[model samples]
Target chain A: MTMTNDAQAVLPPVPGLEDDDPPQLTPAQKKRATSRHLAFQGGTAGKLLGYFGMLAAVLLFFVPLYFIVVTSLKTHGDIYSNPISWLPNPFAPENYSYVINEVRFDKYLRNSVIITGILTVVEVSLGVMTAYGLSFLRFPGRNLLFLLVIASLMVPNQITVISNYALVASWGWRNTFQGIIVPLAAVAFGTFLMRNHFLSLPKEIMEAAELDGTGFFRTLFRVVLPMSWPTLVAFTLITVVNEWNQYLWPFLMSDTDAVAPLPIGLTQLQDNEGLTNWGPVMAGTVLTTVPMLIVFLILQKQMIKGLTAGAVKG
Target chain B: MATVEYQQASRIYDPSRPPAVNRVSLTVADGEFLVLVGPSGSGKSTAMRMLAGLEPIDEGTVLIDDVDVSELRARDRDVAMVFQSYALYPNMTARQNMAFALQNAKMPKAEITQQVERAAAMLELEVLLDKKPSQMSGGQRQRVAMGRSIVRNPKVFCMDEPLSNLDAKLRVSTRAQIGSLQRELGVTTVYVTHDQTEAMTMGDRVAVLREGVLQQVDEPTHLYEHPGNTFVAGFIGSPAMTLIDGATVSSDGRALLGPDHGLDMDLPREYAEKTPGQVIVGVRPENWEIVGHGAAPEDGGASMPLTVRLVEKLGGEAFLHCRAQETEGMTASVRGSQLVLRLDHGFKGIEPDTTIHVRPKPRTSVFFHPENEINLEYL
Candidate 1:
């Protein structure tokens, strides 16, 4: 059983090694290869175009934010000058003091915090429970109930404003925190978002939990909720921003400074100062915008991940 | 360990369509391992779920140790399940996952820790205790899943295709491990799989299901040797038994096979009497004996010419796939007109498109009535 060179002598030459020249490719094949190479490298021109598009998007969104910050620091005279100043000259840092101390912005900030905090907590909790029930629980008309939940999303909020205002007014709930918080606490969008995310989770995990002797609530807290942090955080962030910026319903519901949120307090400030005073008003706008901006910046990565949870499989 | 029984248990997901699991009655002895095996849509998993209390038994009762548990919730049934996907808690460490059921049962923390450590040692998962499911390989995660159910020490273990997700090489080793572990535990277990080889090698008794109906339940050797009908005959064995249809019974009481009537054999009197005009002859791959090339019959056995189409050499054995020359112009059987012959490992010199002669060994062929597809010998 000796190995021999005779076998190699009879073996045919490899197909491309018969000649030194590389095998010729058809035009279509050459084109495909070049395109594939370009795609892998992301082509220099395409990379430049992509960067330029991103720059345009940044400028488009940030310009208004830049205008607000600059206007907030400008003096009353500088704001209305003939040559529009893009930068604040002797930055009127006193404008923030005027809005905070003179206009009593602390009360409105307290009201906003209370309303937004309670609303976000209540809405997110209810959303999670409702989504869990709709996705996991067995019932007679579960699909029909889910349909009703989704159908509510199509209804415009403005159409229900009059009825909500009438109902709150009749109960003598005007100018109260409950009046502003109660109606908005029933979350439809959050329920829909959370339900889709829950449905995307493997159904076998819940079944496994049941076989492990876990009740629905324990399973929800221990097994389900731990895996759903991204969506829950996203839902909470959205709810906080929406409730904090809520204007029309609160304006109709609250008549006094006692329960009026920041949005309503901004209008009160405007009414007191008249149209000529722009510095303090811009300062107040910056104050209201900054809190949400900070929140968004801190949690933006998780918020994006949560929003696109079920759109693609990992 | 406890015995489990299904008294006509059925699950109907939709009223208009056929039941997912039709009325299926089976009984498992204490400490026995029974495998429910079928194709993808054959309701094997549904039947196992019904016993686990994960699925509602729409029509009949399922009992554990003589206690009816049809209305019991999954958690109350005291049965553990290993899902096809492993279904380990992605966020929990392996130790935590195995300890979760004990925690829910309100077992003392010290006892839970001891139980988890013991199960981990048995599964060889000591180093993997702190690793999450995502951090472990597929095989490690599977072992953790097995440990989770073993830690429970429930009355019954329901495993739904637990090895289906592993790589081919790993599946074979894990298959042996699971079999040996089940033997050591000696719990009444019901395992579901679509792989016939897995079912045959693992179960003490394998139950074959088709379209939500139990086809046959028997020991592996018994099921392989004596399948009740054509479906079992064609499905149980690898390469499968080639069934030639349009076989007829001559007026002389001889079983005539092939379109040209090239082969004839004496059938049992009871079988020959029951055959209506046509019969189906089933012959296992190993049962075929290669006679000679273009030679006449020597022992008066039926023989047919075959054209070798492919030769598969599997080191220890070879399977020759050939087309029946006699049945060339006839209507093909359910498995087509190809006949497979299993040969010894040293068999050689056969190539594609070469001609050879083969015949079913004496008394090795099973006869079936063409219309009903029932084994005539059984009838």
Candidate 2:
């Protein structure tokens, strides 16, 4: 009945667990460790050099980000002021405002959001469902269907551009978000990735779900899909990035600012004036790259795992 | 609870070829732990899979609680399966993996939590609950797998060599734990394993399968003592039931155990009453006795001469590898200190290459037709 702070600190000693006392170090071990430490002292200089080299390599990776951020914050004048500054000297936050308010950046943003979101949603949803069916469900022609996807991987996207454009145009989807998003859906890449992941899953788990009275959809929803978090994250990244940077398909179909996403919209900054406003163009580029960077950062752990799964032994 | 009735059920793994499991008529009662055991490539595993709805039945029906699940989907079958690989979700923590099925059942979150906690406690998996399959050790992961099965409360539990992946010591302990847990759970369980030790120690009844055919099904003791066939006789025991070729012996049931050596044994009525010709004789190693009252230490068993070869000591008991002078085979078995004969070293008591007389105790000897390999008779 007494709830005192000290008593609260006195936690219940767990049952079936023995307290683990740290191992005692003998004096000889201590001396050996000291000698090892002294040996490492000379190597410390080399280790510091290696650390700086790693630092340089890491900075090498961030150089693109630094360039984008600096360019995004510079004015057209600052961008061409004799030498383009490595960092924003006189920060022109106005470039963001200009892109945000003046340049139909809102339309570009909306278009990018609609196109990328629909593409991601459609591709991921269909990819996972189709892959689960192919990987786990046994039906005739399943292998043939999987092989078809693999075959599609060999066919260049550039080759499909003309046919896809014609099909969308025939359906009168030109200048619409559907024209941009629909074609990007049902991606072979996502299906391939997710299929491999599901196939790698231990069949016993699936059998257990089957015994638990889980139907096909229920098993997929509650078991297979949830366990494929790593694949989902990795495929999501691939899908988002592919859709975000998609230039050819969008540029081929859309003719106006209202329909075009950023990769196409950013081209408008490079007017036919024979000279370029590198500031807003780079600003648009920065805007285009930010969402994916944020997504990748959030899912780095899953990305690494999924990536390794592709090569690791079963 | 489930009473599994496999009436003429068979599994043809490759319909392009012969069936992996021939027509197997077997029934496992509710709460019975029946182990289907045999060497690799035996149809025992295929039979379990058929019961689980994982392997398609080529013929007849598998009735779980008298419901024919021949055409039913695996999910519709009320059986949980445990694989050798454990197969717990590698991505989810043990708790999540265990809860997956209950979650699908749409159990209230609180109920799911309580049931998961209960199963975890029962399996001693509380600490490992937050750990993924990859994070947990083999024994811990196996417990998590059992926890997943426990949460379901399914009608039948089908295990395919679930203890094989564990280290030897862990396997023994886990096998005992699982055996006891199955008793506590009181669910019908069809366990498939190649290890006869697991079958003998764990099963209420053990069924022996070989080459897609059911050999015999009986209490473990009965299987060992009264095997229905030569395969079962040999498969059910360690140092397997020693068999002597009957085709090379005499007509009055006297076995010529070696060159210039012969011993008279009465023909078992079971074999004599039937086809009275050549028959292989079966005897467990323990049934053998040395018959040299005034002979050397190298003497084997009564009437059978053996040359001492290698001896393996296991604390209290030692297995003497004694080669037969009459055949190409060697008798490997446990011998007490009084009976053991070694040539040299710390065990310098017995000599090597000396002829030792031996004989199998009467009535313990089983006779089989060398052609069919089936028991000469069953009593």
Candidate 3:
């Protein structure tokens, strides 16, 4: 029989700190005191430094935007004479009117809105459906299908542009809205994001739905979709912005102003009397940036939520 | 209401390993509540899931009202389940959750609302009908889950450890509520739980399983008094029965006391004849009494020397946890030396580390075959 020494079995105190009386301050108290001291003595200086750093960063981002606004308002004479100046010597609202009147701004704006709207709807709805199927359903070759989808993410759009152009030309979809939207409607990132969100949904709730006699599509629409609005809204915002700012496909595919969006339309403002006119181009650019900026301001909350959906539970 | 039957249903998850649920046959009469009770991985839950058509039956058929439903999907089988998580839809109010099945079946909107309201009233959940699951308490969510099932009015209600998530006091009250509710609804419910107390208190009949195999199926009282084997004998009762082996039969068909030869008791003729070599003796804690410290053993009752280990005194009764020391010629047949005796609450003053002599009440001890551990009554 082996008997262990009971006294020895008791855990020993930390090295060199063994004593009957404990430390005066508990660890939490010590932490509070140390933080307080740091806040009073060092934190003020560090906080000031941080504020200045943030100011610098904010200025770095906004200064270019301010320059664009000022340049857009300046006349061509003022732009050529003093390019770096902040103020538009003669605040000309005419540059905007000129870009609007001379170029098909209304047509291009309408095209951009239609393309972006339809693309966002198709992409998000298709993404959610694909994600639900990928995450919830158990079908043969599911892993292989998901692997193929993920593999597609690694293939750059440029490599497929020629083949896609050939296919579209053969389908006679050139210069059509379908040509612009359909080629890039189902994005891999959207699927990946939505799949992760759907996967994180509690499995019990889904099983409960199944036993409740709800069909798969009904469960997805009624149960899964309603709970995932933040992620979906965020994804919608991202897709809207991406499709709104699309340049290469629209530029190459559209043979006329009918299908071209603002990004392609902006090029028309570049030439004026055989010289590149900075004023109208800057004007068109500023107008294009304003819509997205407002969209971002309104939907930043959902965008952040969607981007971080599975990283933390709501 | 309809009768449910599992005709040798089995679920084999993998070909190389043993089946998760071996061919298990059982039946529940119309409106009867049968409990599948066992420890985890014992296939009790699997049996319930197989009945619900959640787990596919690889072998044999499950019949609902004598119609084979082994090939039917969960929804097509028309059975409702209450999950242990109380899986109420987080986004929906309790009323909507209850009405979901009807809504999906394309029932009229007015009828759906009326049915939901009736189920809500029956569960006393009318006040909580507007609240989502996240806003409700655990007991309220459990009631909502039950309401969801009850609204369906299906042939069978499958409950898988639905009360396990509740607090102890709430579990007790809700257990009573569910038992009475099942009786009132008169729906055939197959309840699965690992709690023997729940199995005993709630079910019309309890079926015990071990290692994916059915062990015994009987009324709770019958199961308690006449367990078919050692597993049930030890598993059924709280403070489990203390089983001792190495007891042999004497020439007169009486059991000879351990090695000390201080005790002799007559074995039941059936036990003596079936167990000729070595026999296991089982004594439940309550069947044991501690006579006065030096009281003489009488009337052929068997006594053993016990060293008191611990005492748990509940106001009305005391459980004396003790260890019995093997005497000369007694081989170690029991896995551990620990034993327990029940004493009246007023009988105080049992101290630790003190030796005392205890005897099993006459005719209360049982015998089992040493090899298979089956009760001698069956052997």
Candidate 4:
């Protein structure tokens, strides 16, 4: 077949916006045109507002923290003269030393360490086992049992303090580590968190492990635990913080400096100094707060995920 | 390694509702690939899980090697299952996932490595051995799941819709790969799927189930050619067999086609004698042929006088979607008088609104009683 130009038809002129080169415009006109497109297209103004908003939130949290740091460094004279000063007039690192000696801070630190350490380990382990059994195993009254666990969350710690104290006194556990740590570990929050995390796990993977000839404990430790490090870390961080800062239960239980955790020990400074010795009190507060702050900072990501894992479905 | 059997196995998930898997008895021979196929909620997966000892068999026994395994735990039963989700351990690498079962069994490290390596090589997953399941594609993850089961070397392999997770193209290719892989391993396998094509293509023998009841267990050719009932006949084929109900046989052996008396056809004496009242006549799409147009009956042969409502012309064949002019004799066979006729692609220039006379071949037609819908073939 021969090609022919006769087949080609003349093209009709098209209307509307056919110009390849943009029209020349004044700077003001260009500004108007560009601003119209930018206004609805994630305008720079909105992004600037977001950055400023975040900065405001950071400063809001940082101001009180800076005051605590300054107050902890201040001497008695400087603290009273201008209470809200940006910097301490005279630095007295010796206040921490005084508080440590007067409050028997060494014993208290040891007590806090032991109490928090045992509390975290027992709570996390029990939480994991309980969560695993509740999530994976099917038995009669499983959901009812889980509901009972969730129901425990509704019971405030204050209401049970007297009864728990009476029970501990009856067991001759007063001024003992068991009284303090055991009562704290009995809370259901950790189990609830860990159970929700386990519930979100794919059911088939657990079945696969069973068919692979893995026993219950082996599956829990090897398969479930390894995959759940985030939620584990999250629960551990929260538990450590809660155990370290525990006050009323330990205060009511521990009568001696040897058994009291940091929160109760910090109170000794208040009881002795009668509010005049704010320096040592703040210093003790800082000491108790710093270690948990470090833990929270390190595991902040997993902690948030663990805490919120209940609210979000997998 | 062993033959597996379900002797009247049943599972009731909730007491109020019907049993998920009703009493079902089936035997899968050693090294045989048996596929349990049904629609969703049809208890196919429940039956497979019962055999694997994952689901508790409520009222019957599941046996392996002629030993009742009903009371055994899933781990103690020594069976492995590839789940539909391809549930590879997310934290473990592909090699570790495949070797996990062996490790849990306390196999020697060298033996575990050897088995994993062999299975991985069979799956061609050498380069992906170190990759986590999250890092791999769906098909690759599926292979890793298969490799995990293969490393265990269990007595039976229970696969539940393993290919359902893959895309269409990948599903076809992976389906063939799993079929060949099962043949090579020769382990007694019980597979579950809702798709008829997968059941047909993959199984040595396919067991069709409906509403937790076993319909038939037969080879693919037998199931296709000789379904046991209306449900199996309608479900076994792609386009499905068109069943016209309420047809009556005259004393002269001429079977009336429709309730509207639209067409009449001759039936063999054996079938006509067995089916005296209202009967169901099943005709596959390909079996129907266009004989003549705009004419009444000459000799009494079953024919459908229909108007071509639509024409689907593929490159190699055409399906004439016709609608019966009258409503009376039309059964629920091909969706309310909309019958489809598959013809040669060479038949061109056919358009809608044209009339055609279609009849099923004599030997190919099957009859079922209208009330019970059971096959009349035994008579």
lDDT of each: 0.86, 0.77, 0.84, 0.83
Deviation (Å) of A74 in candidate 1: 1.3
Q: TM-score-based ranking, best first? A: 1, 3, 4, 2
Question: DockQ numbers for every candidate?
Answer: 0.39, 0.25, 0.31, 0.37
In model 3, which runs have C-alpha deviations exceeding 4 angstroms?
A1-60, A75-90, A136-138, A170-172, A271-276, A297-314, B257-260, B264-266, B292-302
lDDT value for model 2: 0.77
Number of the predicted model whose TM-score against the real structure is largest: 1
Query: What is the TM-score of each candidate's chain B when compared with the real chain B?
Result: 0.94, 0.88, 0.95, 0.93
Q: What fraction of the native interface does candidate 1 get right in terms of contacts?
A: 0.60
Model 3, range B1-379, lDDT digits (tens) per residue?
A: 9999988889999989988899899989999999999989999988888888778999999999999999988889899999998867766788888999999999999999999988888899999999877778889989999999999999999999999998999999999999999999999999999999999999999999998889999999988888899899988988888888777776557665554465554467666777765678888889876754544445444467777889887767778888876666555355466887787653466678877777677788877788899988876
Q: Candidate 3 recovers what fraction of true contacts?
A: 0.53
**What pairs collide in candidate 4?**
B259-B329, B265-B301, B265-B302, B266-B300
* Model no. 3, DockQ: 0.31
Error in Å for residue A155 of model 1: 2.8
Q: Which candidate is the best by DockQ?
A: 1
State the lDDT of candidate 1 residue by residue for A92-181, as single tens digits.
989899999987799999999999999998999999999999988879999999899999999999999999888888999988999999
Ranking by lDDT: 1, 3, 4, 2
RMSD of 4: 5.5
DockQ for model 1?
Answer: 0.39
